[model samples]
Target: MIGVLIVLCSLHTGFAVTHTGKGCVTGSTGVRDLPEFVAVLMLDEETGAYFDSKTRELQIRLEWALNKVNDSQKYIHYFNVLISSAIPDLMNALQFAMSLYGHSGGIHTLQIMLGCEVSEDRKAGEFMKFGYDAEDFISLDISTLAWIAHSPQAGIICADWNNHIETAQFWKGILENECFALLKKLVEYDREILERKVPPEVSLLRRDPSSPVTCLATGFFPEGIVVSWQKDGEDLHEDVELLETLSNEDGTFQTRSRLTVSPADVKEHNYTCVVDHSSLEKNIIKPVTEEEIKTNQDPENSLPVGIIIAVVLAVLLVAIAAFAC
Candidate 1:
C-alpha cells in the first residue's frame, strides 16, 4: 500500500505543538542515502467559524497518527516531521516544507475539497482533467474518483493538516491569494446583502461631531456582518472611533459606533448610515431635523434665472460655432 498521510482541517483554532527540538520522526522516503518525507498541510484561516465535534475528532486522529509515526523507530528510523503554520496555499506549503528540510527534491501532496461549487472535484469532465493534468498530483479524498472519470493517479487518501502534506493544487504560492479571494468574497457578500429591501437589519450610526463613531453593535452576526456609519457616501475613519459589535440571542448583532461630529457642521446635514449586506443593501438616511439655516448662504443647489439663461446662451453659442466649423 502507498504511504498514507492524514490531514485534519481543524487547526485554524490553533494547536500547541510541543517542539522538543529533538526532531519528531514522521516517516521515511524509503531511500538508502537520502530518505525524507516532507509534511505539508493546508488549513483555511477563515473556517474558524465552522468548528464542531467532527473536526475535533479529526484533530485527535491527526495527533495520534503523528505520535504513532514518531514512536516507531524500527520501520522509519531518524525521520523528521516539522509543523508550519499560516500556509493557506497548497503548492506554497509544499515548496516551503521541501526547502525547510534541505532536501534536494520531493513532491508535496495536498487535500482537495472544493469549498466552492467549481472545486476540481465537482465534475468528472474538463475541470477535473484540467486540474490533474496541471501537475504531479495526489488526491486526498477517496470519493473524488466516484464523481470523476477513470484516472490512475488521483486517489482518495486521508490526511491530517498538523503533520501531513497535501495533494491539492492552489493558484498561487502564497496564502495572500486566498486572503484576497476572501476579501473579495467579503466585499461582494457585503454588497449583495446590503442590496436587499429588508436591509439585513443593518444600519450605520454616525455621530454628529464626526470624531469617529466608535461603538459596539449588539444585536445578529456581529462578525459576519459589518456595522459602519457614513457621511456624504464615504467611509468614516475607523481610527476616529473603533466599533465593538455584539451579537444577540436571536443571532442578530447590534453595533454602536460612537463618533463626535461637529454639531454645528452637521446639525442639519444629510448624513446617511449605509449598510452593505449580502442580501439587503438599503441605507437609512438620518433625518436632518435639527435643520441648519445659513443667513448668508450662497445657494449651490440652485442657479439664478439670469445666470441660467446666460449659461444656456453660452452653450448654444458654442454648439452653433461647432456646427459651423
Candidate 2:
C-alpha cells in the first residue's frame, strides 16, 4: 500500500482555508505472473477514484466512473499509462532497498509519498514540501536527485544539485493552481453520486431451536445504520450483543445484533428487531415469533406432503396394470 499526506492552507478574509489530496499506488504479482497495480486518488476525503489493474476498471464512489466520463476510452488510457509506467521503477527500488536491509524474496512494498504544506500570516509565509520513497529513505527535493537521508552522501547531494529557491516557488504555484483546481473539479463532479443512499435489507434468523435470536442488516450504504432489539414496544438493552459493522466487497456494510432470551420470556413477551437509517422514510420493525423461528429453522418441511400420497397411488395403478397383463 502507498500512503501520501498533503496539506495546503491559505489565509482568506481572516480565515484559514485548507485543502488536502493524497495519491497511492500499490502493485502485486497476480496469477498470470505479471505485476498488477491498484491506484487510489483522494481529494479532501470527499471525492476519490480507484483503478484496479486486474479488473481493468476505474471505480469512483463505489461505481464505475469511467463510463460517466465524456471520453471514457481516453480517460481509461490515461490512467493505464499513468499506473503502468510507475510499476517497474517502484518494484526495482523496493527490491534494492530490501537487499540493503538484508531482507530477501517475499512480497515487499515500496511507497512514495509527496506532500506540500503552506501556511501564511501577516508577517511571514511558510512552505514545506517533500517526496520520498519510504523503504530506503531515498527522497526528492525541488532540484536534487534521490538521496539517502542522514547519510554521508546527503552532503554531496545537497551541495551539487540544490535549487531550493526555484523549487519552492514552483511548488507554491502548483499547489494553489493545479492541486486545488483538481480538487474543486472532482468535488463538483461527484456531488450527486456521493450523496446517494441505499436502504438496508433487514432480516431476522434463528439457525437452531436453542440458538440466540440474530437480527441481521446487510447491503446498507453510507454506514449510519442503527439496529436494536425491542420487547413489547420498548427497547431492550440488557442481554443484547451488537457486532461491529463489517464492509462488504461491494462497498456496502453489514451488522448483526444478538438477543438472548429464555423460553419462558419468549412465550410471554413479543420481540422485534428495529432498524433506523437515513434511506428509510420510516423505521423498519420486524417482529420475531415462535412460528417465524420454527419456519426459519425448518423451511424444507413446508413442502407439500400430498406429493408422497400421489406417488403411492401412481405405483399402485402400475402394479394393477401389470397383474392384469
Candidate 3:
C-alpha cells in the first residue's frame, strides 16, 4: 500500500497559551505536494519543532523551545517514537475508512487534530477530532469522554474507540495536566514576546475616486483591536465593512474597515478612520481626505508599490482565520 502524511499546527484566539497538533495520512502515493508522513509541534502560533518521514529526524525550530527543555534529545526521542508508531496506524486507519466507505482507485486522506487551551481566567478546553477528505468524521467529547461519529463511516471507529476507556483517560490526563503544565511553562518562558504590544501603522486607501475608502491598520501585536468609521464626529455604521484581523509573518496583525460612499458625498462630508488598540495611549484618528487617501488611479496619490506588495503578502500568509466573531 502507498500513502502520504501531513501535519499542521495552529493557535487559538484569546487563550493565554494554546497548543495544537495534527496528523494526516493518505491511502495512495504520487499525491502532489504531500510528503509521505510529517509531524509538527507548535507553541501558541509559533512552530517549535517538526519531523518528516523523509528526514527521519526531529528538528528543533525555535531556540527558546530548545533552551526551555533540559534534555532536548530525550524530548526529540519521545516525539520520534510517537510519530514512528502513529504513521502506520494512521495509514491503516485511512485505508480502513476508505474501504468501509467503498472508496477506491483514488487518493483519500484521513486527518487527526488534537489541542488544548488555557484562557486568562483559568478556563481550559481540549479537543480531538478526525476528518476524512477534509470533512468531519469523528470527534472525542472531552466532557463526556465519549466518541461522537459525524458520519456513518465513522460509526465503527467510534464504537471501537469508545470501548477503550483507558485511551480516553490517557488523553484526558495529558490534556488536563501535562498539556496545561507544558503550555503554562512555555508561556512563562516567552512571556515578554507574547505579551508585548506593538502599535499599528494606520493608512487610508482607495482604488479610485468611485471606490470605497479603506482604513487599514497593520503591524499591530496582541490581536485585540477595533477598526471603525466615523462621519462628522459620529460613528458611521451604514455602508461599512469591517474585515477580520489577519496575521503577518512577523507575528503582528493587520485589519481594515471600508466605507462605501459616493465621491460627491466623500468630498462634502468629513470622514475618518478610528483605530483602538491596547498598545496605543489613545485611539488613532485618520481623516479620509482626497490628499491623504492612497489610490492607484491618481498619479499624485497613488498607493506606494511596496505597501501594495505587503498587503498581498499578508493575505497570502493567512493560513486560517484566527478570529471568528
Candidate 4:
C-alpha cells in the first residue's frame, strides 16, 4: 500500500514579450502536509491567482489582474464556481488512476497542466497534459485536437476522452480564444512594467588565481543577450563554456561564461569577456586581469575595479537606450 500520494503539473512561464497563462490542478489523498486539492494560475510565469480546497476561494496574486476586467467580481465568482465544479471530477480521476497503478494506499498525485501562449510573431499555441506520480501519463495534441497517451494505463483513458469529440472542441475554444485573449489583456494592463529594460551587472569571478575565470552577468531584462570569451582580439570557443540564460526572481535574467586557461597563459594573453544586449549602446568588454577578479578568499572586499566601472557605464547606456525608446 502506498502511504501517501500527490500529483502536480509541470509549468514553466515565458518571457515578458511572449505573454502566457498557465494553470495546474492537483488532487491528493492521505497527505498530511499537503492540501487534498489545489489549483494555481500564472500569467507570464508569475503567479496571477491561486486556490485550494481549504479556502474554497479564487484569490488574486496580482492586484492589477482584476482591474481591467469588465465584471471583476463576476469573473472571480465564475472561476470559483468553475474550480468547485471541477474538484469532484478531479477526485474521481485521481482514484481511477490510483486503481490502474494498483496502489491501494500511500501518497499519490495526479496533475494536469494547461496553458496558452502568444509569441512575439503573434503565433499562438496551447497545451494540456496529465501526469501521475510526476511522470507524463497523457497529453493533448492541440494541432490534431486528440489525446496522446504516454503510458499503458492512459490508453484506455484517452480512448474514453477521445470519444467525446465535442468536449475536446469546447476546451480548444477556451484555450485558444478565451485563454489567449485573457493573457493578451493581462500583458496590456502591465505593458509599462513588462516592456521596461534593465541593464545587467557584470562581474568576473574566480575561486582563486589558479581557477578558471567566470564572467557573470545578471539582472538584465528581455532574456536576449550574448556572452562570449575572446583572447587577444580573437574568438576563443575552445575551453570556454557558455551556460544557459536563467530567469531572476524580479523577471530579469542572468548568465555565465567560463574560460579555462592556466594562470601563466592568462597573464601572457589578453582575455576579455564580451557581453552584448539590447539595453547597451556598445558591447561591454572586460579584460581578465588579476586585479579585476573577485575571489572567494576575500569576498567582502573583492569587488573588482574593472567591474565597478563597467557597471556604471552599463547603467548610463541603458538609461540612454530607455530615453531613445
TM-score of each: 0.27, 0.56, 0.69, 0.67
- List, residue by residue over 90-120, the lDDT tens digit for candidate 4: 7777888898888888988777776778776
Task: Name the top TM-score candidate.
Answer: 3
> What's the lDDT for all of these models?
0.28, 0.49, 0.62, 0.67
Q: For candidate 1, what is the lDDT? A: 0.28
- Write down the TM-score for model 2: 0.56
List, residue by residue over 1-325, the lDDT tens digit for candidate 3: 2211222224345543433322222323346656555545455555455555667676665565567677778867766665555556556666677787998747666655555566552536777666677678887788889989999878977788788877677667766775566566666667786778899999888888889888888888777899988899999999999886766656677878889999988788899899999999999999988888888531232111101001111111111111000
Q: Write down the worst ten-residue block by lDDT for model 2.
A: 303-312
Q: Arrange candidates by TM-score, descending.
A: 3, 4, 2, 1
* Best-performing candidate as measured by lDDT: 4
**Tens-digit per-residue lDDT, 42-77, candidate 2:** 433332455555665544542433444667566656
Please give the distance, in angstroms, between residue 199's alpha carbon in candidate 2 and its true position after superposition.
Answer: 4.2
Root-mean-square deviation (CA) per prediction: 24.9, 20.6, 9.4, 12.4
Worst 10 residues of 1 by lDDT: 303-312
